[model samples]
Target: MKSLMQDVPLTLDVVLRRCLETGVGVEVVSATPAGTVRTTWGEIGRRATALTGVLDGLGVPAGGRVATFAWNTHRHVELFLGVPCAGRVVHGVNVRLTDDEILYQLRNAGDEVLFVDASLTDRLAELADRLPVRAVVVLDDGAPVNPVFADAPRYDALVEAVRETELVPRAKPDDAAWICYTSGTTGMPKGVVSSHLACVVHSLSSMTVDSHAVSREDVLLTVTPLFHVNAWGLAYTSALANAKLVLPGRDASGAHLAELIEAEHVTVGAAVPTVWVDLVGQPHRMDSMRRVLCGGAPATRSLLDAIARRGWAFHKGWGMTEMLPSGTMQVQPPDLDLDSPAGAITRVGKPSAGVRVRLVGPDGQVLPWDGRTTGELETSGPWVIRAYLDPDDDSNDTRFHDGWLRTGDLAVIHPDATVEIVDRVKDVIKSGGEWISSLALEQALAAHPGVAEVAVVAIPDDKWGERPAAAVVAADGLAPCAEELVKFLAERVPRWWLPERIVQVDALPLTTIGKPDKKALRARLSSPSRS
Candidate 1:
C-alpha cells in the first residue's frame, strides 16, 4: 500500500515559498540593453504576486494558460517563477516559429492570456482572433505604453496598480504546472504536459554536481529561448535552486553571448553547439567558462575537443521535450577508453542521477550494456511525461511501450551507464541493407580544417534504397569540391560510409531551437544543389 506521507506537498509554489524564506535577497542578474540589471528573489516573488493579480484581472483561472512569446529576460524569468508559482500555466511559445504554426499551437493549447514583448506585438495581432487569448500584456523595461491590441487587454496597465497580492497558487503535485510544444515541422508540435511533481523530481535528480552542476554561488548564462521546455528546465531549477541566473536578453548572437559570459563571470552556460562553436571561433577566450551544458542536437567530437582544450567541460545533454528534457548527461566516465580516439573526451556522463535508462529491441527485450548494442532509448522516471495534450494520435502512440517513453533516439549505453546517441531513429539511413550513421559522417566531416559546418542526409538511390549526401559550408577562400571532401572523409570513415554527394554552401539551415535542419537538408536532396 502507498504511504499517506507520499501525498505530501510537492507543488512548485512550495519550492518558491521555501526559496523565499531561504534564498531571499539572492541576486538575479540579467544583462539588458540598459546595461546589466539586478534584482533579488524577494522582489521577484513580489513581482510574481503582482503578476498573479494581473493574471486574475485578465481572467486567467487556475488551469488557464498564460502564454509568453518573449526572449530570455528578467521579465520572462519572472513568469517562470510567478505564473506557475501563482497557480497558472505559462505556455512559453517559441518566437522563431512561423506565424501559422505559432498560431496553430496557440489555438491548439487554448491560451487564455498572453504576455508578449513589445517587439513581437505584431506577431500577436496576426493571431489575435484565431487564438483564444482574452488579454495581451506587452512587457518592457521602461514606462509602459499600450500596443495595438484589437480586443485583448493591454498587460502593462493591467498589472500597474498591483501591490504584491499574496497569490499563493494552489496546485496538487500531480496537477499540470506547465506545458511545452515541440517544433511541429514533422507534424503539429505535440504539447508536452508536465506536473509540478514531475518538474521538481527532475530538478532534484538534475541538481547533483555531476548533472547540471548548479550551485548558489554559480551563475548560469543562457539564450536557448524560454519557449523550449521552460528554457530546457533551466528557468525552474535556477529560481528554485537560488542559482545566479544571467539572461542573454534577446541577443543570442555569438558576440552578445560571449560578453554576458565574461561580464557576469558565468561559470555555467548552455546553448546549442552552433552557438558555442561560434563563441569558440572568436579570437580569444572571453572568460574562463568552466562548465557548458549543450543539447538540442548531438555535440560532435570535434566541437567537444575544442572546448576541452580551453579547459571547458562540454557535457552532452540529451533529452526530449517530454521528459522536461532531463534524461541523460554525458560526463567523462572513469573507464573512458582514452586510447580509443573518441574516449579522450567526455560522453553524456550517465543517466541523470535518478533517471533509469534502458535500450531495448523490438518485442520489449532489454539490450546489454556492452555499448555495442544499439536500440531505441526508452525511459521512465519521476519527470517523464505520461501522455500528450491530444493523446489519441497514432504517430505518438508508438512512441511509448508500457509506461516507458520511446525516445526515438538511437543510442548505446556503455557498461558505466553513459548514454551516447549516434543518430535519431527516423534519420538513420539504410542503404542496400547497410546502416549508415549520419551523425558519424557529420562528426567526421566537421573535423576537416576547411569545413565550417556540415549536415548529412540520406538521399534516394535506385541501386541502394538510400545513400548519404552532405550539405557543407567551407572555410573562406576554400572551394573544396564534393569529390575532394569525399576523399577527405574516405580516409576516416569506411568506404561505404562516405557520402556519395556533397552540396557546398555558406551556412546550414537550422531549426528554431538551433538544431541543424536535417529536414531542410533532406529537402535539398530532392533537387540536389550545385555550387
Candidate 2:
C-alpha cells in the first residue's frame, strides 16, 4: 500500500527560499545606538549566503557548533539563518548569564567558534583565557573593541572577504539545527536540540490561524531575547510569513519599545509578562498593534486589565524548552465569558495542532479533564524532544517517561480543553498532606492595589511539613500593608492556603530570564537573620 507523494525534505532552506522569493518588499529593521538601520529581505538573504562562506573560510567543520553571544539585532538574525541553513548548529548563549554559567555552557556544548558583540567584549575578556573556542569574531555595534578582542577579526571584514558561495542546505531534515539551554534556576542547565524538520514544522504551526496568525501584512516587534528559545520562533515565523521583522537592540526599556512600535507600526509583538508590565503606562501610539503574546510567567489580572484598557488583544502562551518553545496558545472562544474566572482568556488555552497533552496522577494514572482535578502535565508530539543532548545525564530518567515529556507543571485541563497551570511540582506547598498552589497565591496577591509584584515559596514548618511564605514589592511610592494583603487573599483562596509569613521587599529577585527566583527566595526566607 505505497502512496504516491514527493519525498522533499522539510528544512530551513525551504523556508529561506520561500522568504526571499515572496518577500521582495519586506524589510528587517534593527535599532542601533547610532539610529535605526533597515534592510530588505533580499539583502539579508545575500548577507546570509556570504556568512556561510565566511564559516567555510574559518575552517569550521560541517555540523560543528557555533556559539553567538550578542543582542537581538540584524547581525544576530544573520547567524540565525546562516549557521543552520549551512548545516552548522547555532548555539545562542544567554548573554544575561553569569561568567561561570556562560563558561559552563560553552564547554558543555563544545563550541568551536565564538561570535560576540563589541559592547560585550569586557565580559568575554574575563573568560578569554578559559574559553574553549578556537577563534573569536566581533560584531561591531558602535562600541570600542576591548584589548582582549583586538587580535580577533571583525565580523563584517570576514563576511566581506569570503567569496559568495552557492546557497544550498547541507543538513538533512532530521539533523540538528539549533541548541537552546534551559534557564536552570534550580540546577545546571541542560541543552535541548531542535531538528530542521521540527523547526520548520513549528514555524508553520505558529503561522496558522489559531496560533500567532502571522502574515505578510503584519509587522512583528520581537521583544523577547533572541538567545531564548529562538525568540519564541518569531524570527523564523517572520521570514516564512514575509512579515516585517523589528529588532530592538540592547535596550528593551518601556520608552524605547514604545517608540519602536509607533515608529515601525508594529502589528504583533511577543515578550514576557514582566516586559508587558513595564509597557502598561508608557505613553505611545500603539493603535496599530493587533495582538500581544505573553509567556515565561503567568500574567496577573491587573496586567491583563491594563492591556484591556489600552484596547489591545492579549494572549497568554504556554511552552517549554523541550516543546520547541510553544505548545498551547490562548485563543478566545465564541462562547467564553470574559469576566468568568475560568474563561479561555484566563487559562493557557488548548493544546496546539499536532500536539497532545494529558495529566498524570502521582500513582501513574491518567487524570480526566473535569476542570477541577490537578496533576503533572505530560505532552507528546513530533516537535517535542525525546531526551536531552547528554544521554549519560541522570535527569533524563525522570524527565521522559512512557514516551511523554513530564512537564513538571501541576495543571488542570477543563472539559473545553483549556489548561490552567497551578504551580511547578517543586514550588507547590505541602501543608498537612494537602497541596497548595504558589502561583494561585501570587496571582491573588498581585491584584492588590498596593502590591506591584509577588512571589510565593515553600518554607519548612515542623507542624505542617511545609507552609507558604511570601515576598512582596510595593507599588509606586506606597508601602503595602501585610494585614491588608492577607485579607485580600482570604476571600479568593482557601483559609489554609494563606501564607504564614509576609515580608515587604524593594524588588523581587529574578532569574537571568526574568522569572521570579523562587529557589533564591526560599533560601532568603529560610536564613537565620530573617527568622
Candidate 3:
C-alpha cells in the first residue's frame, strides 16, 4: 500500500504568503529616481496584490512573459512576486547589456508587457517601433518627466485604476515562473527558465549556515543587480527568512552602498569583487556588515584582507544562470590555517545543500577529489538546469551532458568538499606545452599593493602560441612600474609563467554585469591601436 501524505505544492506563492503572515514588521527600502521610499512587507503584499489587477486588466495571458527594464526599486520588487504569482512569467532584462543584446532578449523572450523606470524610458524609445512588446508601462509617478512611448501608459495610472483583490497564486509549483538570459560572452545569449518549485527550493537551501544564513533579524543589502540571477536568490531568501531587504536602486556606487549599510544597519550583503574593491577605497564606514557574499569573479587576497581587517566575514561564492544561480558558498574549516599557501580565501566553497558536483577530465573520466587534479566542473541537483530554452541550439550538446550541466569552469575539488576555480576553460593560457592559470596570475598581481584592478588574458605570441598578458589599473597616485610588478610576481610564480606584456590602463574594460570584459580586452590587444 502507498503511504498517505499531503502533496502540497512548493512555489513562490507559499514564500510570499509566509512572509505576509509572519513578516508584517519587516521593511523593504529602496532608493529610486523619486528618492528614497520605505514600505513594510504587509504594504508590499497589498501593492503586489493590487498589481495583479493591472496584469489582469491588461489581459496578460496565463504563463505570459512580463518583462521589466527597471532598477532595484520598490516597484520592480512588486513585479518580482506579482507577475509570477498571477500565473505569468517575470523576465528581468539586464539594463547593462548592449542595445543589440537588449533588443534580442526583448524579442526572444516574447515579452508582452514591458515595465521600465522613468529614467530608463528613453531606452524603450530607442527601439520604440521595432519592439515586440504590446504595451509599455513606466515605473514612475510623473515627478521626473516621462519620455513619450507613442501610446504607452504611466505605471501610476495603471496601479491607481486596478482595485486590490484578495491575493492568490494562479500557477502550479512546477510551472515556469521566471526567465533570465546568459551573459553570452561566447555567442548569442541563451535563455534559462526556472520553475516555481526550483526557486522555492533554492530559497530554503540558501538559508543554511553554509550559505547566506538568512534569518529574521538579518538586514541584507542587495548590491547585486536584480537582473542578475534574481540578485543571487536574495529576493526570495530574504522573504523566506523574514529578513529586512534594502535595494540600492541604480546607484550601487561604493559611497552609496557604504551609506546604505551604515544607515540601515545591514548585517549581510552580496556583491561582485569589483564592487568590494571600490568599497575598500571609499571613505565610508562598513562596521554594520557582518558577512558579505562575493561572486561574479574571483576575490583577491588583498581585497579579502581589507575586509578581514574590518572584523567582517568574507565569503567566495560561485554560480551560473543555468544553475538557478546557487552553486557553492565557501565556508572554511575550523582547523584550516588561512595564512598557508593552500589556505587562500578565494575558493568558491563547496556546493550548496541539495546540489552535487563532479569533475570530468578531458579523457572522459571522473577525477579524484584530491585537490590537485583539475577538470571541467559538472553539476546536477534539484535546482540545476538540465537544458537551455532552445533545443535547436548547438550549445545544448556541449553545455548539458547526461542531466549534468557542463559548467565550462576549470576547477579542483578538495577532499574537504571545497572548490577552487582555476579559470574558465577558454581562458587558461598555454605556453611551452604547459597550461597556466590566468586567474592565478591576476591574483598574484593584485597583491602588489599598488595595483587597484587587474585582468589577465592570453595574447597570441608566435613563440609560445599564447602567453599571459596582464592589463593593470594602478591605484590613484600610486603607480607601480611594470618592471616592479614583474619582479613582484617572479617570487610567487614560475618565471616562465610571467606575463609577457604589462599594459597599463586607466581602467579595465568590464562586461555589462561588471566582470572584466576579457573578450573586449583581447580584441583591443589584437587591434592596431596599441601605442
Candidate 4:
C-alpha cells in the first residue's frame, strides 16, 4: 500500500544529516552541574555518526531497541539522534520508574543494548540480570564500570573507536525511530513507538508553534528530561533552526535549574508547572529567560501571572503520551486581552498546526464547538499515535476508529476552535446525578494568591454518588486552612459546585511522569467500597 507519501524519505534521520551539511555552524549547548558544555553542529554530526559505528560493532540489529537509562546531558542528546537515525529504536527509559517497573519495561521492550550514564551505573548494574541486554554502555568515563554486568562498555571509548567515520546508514521515513512508554496507571507501562516521519512532523510543528519559538541565535534550556518525548521534541526542531540546545542534566530542582538558566544565558525553555514554582518564586537571577513552554500538567493561573510579571512569557500546553506527547498549546491569541482575568489563560488553547480535534458524546456523536457542551475529546492526525504498544498484546486496532484515535480526554470547543479541558472523562465528580469538573475547582483555587498547590478529586458521599474535595498548599504568610479556601472557592463556583471538603498538604502527589496522581489521591482519601 505504499501510497507514495515521499520517496525522498522525509525522516528525522534525513533532517539531522542535512543539518550537519547545511547548518554545521549552528550552536548546541548542554548544561550540567559539572559545568556547561558547548559543541558545534559538526561535532554533533561526528559524534552521532561515530555512535552508529559503536552500535554496529555491538551487533545491534537494525530493528533492535537500544535503551538509555541516563540523565539530560549532551551525551544523552547524541543518542537522541544517533540510535534512531542508525535504523534502530531508541528507548529512552524513564529513570523515575520503580525498580520492579523498570525491569518490567526492559523485558517488555525486549531491549538488548543498554546505555547507562555513569551517574546511573551503580543503580543500573543491579538490574543487569533482569534485562536481556547484550551490552551495557556507561556515560561517565572516570567512574569504574560496575562489574555487576560482564558485558558493560564505556560510552566515550566506543565513540573514540569510530571517530574517523564519515557517514552512517540512514533509516527510511516509516522505520521506527524511537520508543516512549505511557504510564500504565491501571497496570504495566505500554510502549508508544514513533516513526521517523511522525517524529519529524512533530518536531517541526513544535518548533514553529513553540519550542521557545527559537531562531538561529536563541539558546534553549531542556530541563525537561530528554527521555520524555525526545524532551518534548525541542532537539529535533532546534537543530535545523540553528538554535543552541541546552541540557540541564538531571538536577531539575529549582536552585540547580536557576543557576543553569542564568549561567548559560538560556533564552527559551520548557518544564512542568512544579519545576518552575520554586525557581520563579526564588531569590535568584533569571533575566536571560525569554519564555517557558510548560506541560505534563496545567500551569496554574497564578504561576503564569508570576512568570509574566517577571517579563518572560509563559506558554501553556496540554498533551498525552500518545500525541508524541504534544497536542494543544496556548500562545496568547492575537485578540486576547492582555489584561483579561485569570480565567483566560487556563484553557488548553487551539489545535497544533498538524492535529485535529472533535468533541464527542458517549454515543460517539460529534458535538458542536460552542464552548458549552463538553464531551470526550478525540483527535487524529499526523504524529498522533494510532495505538499503544502492548506487551500482553492487546488489540490496538480497537484504539482507533476510522482513522481517528480516542484520546480519553474531555474538553469543550469554543467557536474559534480553542479548547478548554474540563477533566479526564473518568475524573469528573459526580454528585446528585450531575457531573462537575474537578479541573475547574483546582483552577479557581490556583487563582488565589495564598495557594501554592491544589488538587481536586472525588470522595464518597452516601447522600450524593460522589462529592468533590480539594487538597491545597498554603501560600506565604498564610496558614494552611481548609475553611478559608472553601470560602474563597464559593465566590467563583456555585455553592453546589464548591469542594465539599478541603485538606491542606505541603505538596500534591505527582506521578512519576509529573502529572497529578488523582487516582492515588482518591485512594488515599477514601477506602474502597463494594457499593
Instruction: Assess candidate 1 and give its lDDT.
Output: 0.76
> Model 3 off-target regions past 4 Å?
1-4, 141-143, 332-337, 529-531
Whole-model Cα lDDT of every candidate shown, in order: 0.76, 0.86, 0.84, 0.78
Query: What digit string (tens of lDDT, one per residue) describes model 3 on residues 318-390?
Result: 9988887889987543344557745674578889999999999997789999989999999999888887887
Candidate 1 vs candidate 2, lDDT winner: 2
lDDT string, candidate 4, 189-306, tens digits: 7788898999888877876744336567678787778777778877877776767777777678888888878887888778888888878887777888878778888777667777
Cα RMSD (angstroms) for every candidate in the order listed: 2.8, 1.8, 1.9, 3.1
TM-score ranking, high to low = 2, 3, 4, 1
Candidate 1 lDDT by residue in tens digits, 1-531: 976665557777766774566667677777655667798766666676687788767778888887888878878877876787667787888988887877877887888877887656666665665766766677764423334553445555665678766656577788878889877657678989888888787776667877787777778887678888888777667776788788887777778788777777788887888888777666657665788888887665556666766677666788889888878776643333434734633245578867788989867899998878888889988888677887676755777888889888888888878777877787889999989988888878877767767888888888999999888888656778878888889898999988777888778899888888878778787564423
Better of 1 and 4 by TM-score: 4
Better of 2 and 4 by lDDT: 2
Predicted structure 3: lDDT = 0.84
Would you list the rank order by lDDT, best first? Answer: 2, 3, 4, 1
Task: Quote the positional error of residue 460 for candidate 1 in Å.
Answer: 0.8
lDDT of 2 by residue, 89-162 (tens): 99999999998999999988889999999988988887899999999999988888899899899998987787
Using lDDT, give the best candidate's number: 2
